[model samples]
Target: MIQITNLHKSYKTGSNSLHVLKGINFSVKEGELVSIMGSSGSGKSTLLNILGMLDEADTGSYVLDGVTIKNLNEKQAARYRNKFLGFIFQSFNLISYKSALDNVALPLYYQGMARGERMDRAMAYLEKVGLADWSGHLPNQLSGGQKQRVAIARALASDPKVLLADEPTGALDTKTSYEVMDLIQQINDEGRTILVVTHENDIAHMTKRIVNLKDGLIIEDTPVQQVRALENV
Candidate 1:
């Protein structure tokens, strides 16, 4: 669950300031799949970064699963991030030399988990993502969709409370994107709160709710009939 109110953020460029988010307010409940939709420069990325605790808001309040998020030291922020959030990026962020299994296991490795337990958890998630058979394959060895699946597995391996995906299917073909979205929908059905930041209409429609952002503010936030990606595929 997430609650944000009156969020405001800006960046300074020499003598001018670029305002990224303005008076943003929203809440996402548990078991909900939501998409933040916006064009480039609409502040969706800024909002996602703030939500992921990768960046700080200039002003406002953010509450994640009952914990207030504000003014924390780097160490404290990192601890909360590891304990509560997981991320999936469009770029697939995997190490070129690491096998799929090793890539999935990296987060657990950061948590100081032992090799045996880490491998066990990693394999379980890889299997969950239907990538168990490809565990030994490296990123370059896999296709775009396959790499994204591996990224999804890696994000879930840590068992975080919320999954944050930014342009999750941006780099894939339409068919592959549908497949990836189907997996995301299935994961949401199992009751994990998922927030996707995307500009594609079809991608946003796959989610239960869509929050449309324009010029750094939410213009529309509404629930809609969930679009099944498999049907579209």
Candidate 2:
């Protein structure tokens, strides 16, 4: 569902330029769960940002679900991003005052969905994530895993084509992390295209494929035997 070729990205720092991604190439098919693995300064976040259309590449080609992604105006990019992409961040990005239900309903609000319909959709996703009973709870009221589950529900409420997760499970204890990963694996098994950006080996192993990045380039891309997080949990 994603294709990239000769992707290059750089940032100017004073008089010097820091190259972030160099000659990156890869493709993710529909229904695949992939992880981008790298250490600090390895360009994984840069690649994920480009893939999510949150940032533009200096040069290269990116096609998402048959649409070429390049040179779009801000309005056009936002429209496409809303229609095709969903994101989960490590920070949970929820408004402090918003309840879990309200948080999940926020994206549908941006889509111009009416309150009644949006609430119904958001509740359905919250139910799917096993958080229906906690709908009235705020982020601070929930545990880290519960907050991440709310975030996952929010990400899915829009029904986007691909899910882009950055450091999912990074902040939780081992058991909670495994529980979150189990949910993610279940989502992928149901045919959602997911790309997780993470540095943890166990986290990467939970995905079907791992793309290792080093010094702004992909050093290794390979499929591996999947590790079921449920077993670990």
Candidate 3:
């Protein structure tokens, strides 16, 4: 589970102070799929980055799975992030030259797992995301949907407790978007908590909960009925 309170983050541009996050307070329970919806400049991505431990907030507190990130040093933050968080991006951040299997195995490699074990785990996750047949294919050889699936597999490769995805379906067509969303839902059903930031309402509806952000504050938080996972197809 993750808890954040009075979380404030700001940036300095020349002589102006840009307040991106203003006292964000929210909690994400274990195994819950939560969607964060916001418009441009709503600070959703900033909040996600802070939650992902890639950016530090200037004030307030963030407790992820019981550890306070406000006090962690750079190395400590890196270690904790590697251990507890997985990320999916709209761009499908994959190494163009690496095969899908190798792309998934990259995280495990960073975790220092043995090559054999890492390869095994990567292959398993690839199958889980319906990319087993494309394991040997390069990113360019795959379709947009396949690339996103590989990204999802890479995110799951680390076996993190939480998966944070940003605009996951932004680059794909409607059908492919639905497919990617379905795959993410399946992962959530398997008990991995997911917090996704998306501008698409339909995509947000797939999640069990919705949190809306505006002007750096949480304007609305509501829980919807649990929808059928991977049944949207």
Candidate 4:
């Protein structure tokens, strides 16, 4: 579960400050699948950074899974991020030289997991994402969707409390995007909290809830019938 109240953030440009998030209040419950929809300069990225702990809000409170997130040193912040959040980026963010299996195991290695245990866990996640057979393939060797699947497996290998995906389906074709979304939905069904940041309307619709942002404000937050991606694909 996550909660942020009256969040405000700003950045300086020369002498002027551009406010990114203003008096925003939002929360995502455990096991919920939510999407944040916004245009360029809509502050969705700022919000995501704050939520992902990549950047802290200038003011307000963020609590993740019962831990208050504020004023932490980089070391502390990194620890919390590694322990509680998994990230899937649009570009997949895989190392070009690392094989899919090693890519998935990277986080666990950072966490100081033993080699044998981490590899086992990584392989399990690869299988979970239907990429077991491609475990030895490098990112360059896989197709766009398969690369994304490898990213998803990497995210899950940490077994974090929440998955924060930024434009998860943005890089793939419609069919591939739906396939990835289907995997995400299945993950949510198993009780992992997920928050997707996307600009596509159809992508937002795939989630159970949509939070619309504009000019650094949450203009709309609504729950709707979930669009089953597997059915559509």
TM-score of each: 0.99, 0.99, 0.96, 0.99
Q: How accurate locally, in lDDT, is each candidate?
A: 0.96, 0.94, 0.91, 0.94
lDDT of 1 at 79: 91
Q: 98-187, model 2: which lDDT tens digit per residue?
A: 999999999999999999999999999999999999999999999999999999999999999999999988888899989999999999
Residue lDDT tens for model 3, 1-233 = 99999999999999999999989999999999999999999999999999999898898888888988876788898789889999999999999999999999999998999999999999999998888998999999999999999999899989898999999999999878888888888888889999989999888998999999999999999998765535666
lDDT of 2 at 42: 97
RMSD of candidates 1 onward, in order: 0.7, 0.7, 1.3, 0.7
The sequence of per-residue lDDT tens digits that candidate 4 reaches over residues 132-159 is 9999998999999999999999999999
RMSD of 2: 0.7
* TM-score between model 3 and native: 0.96
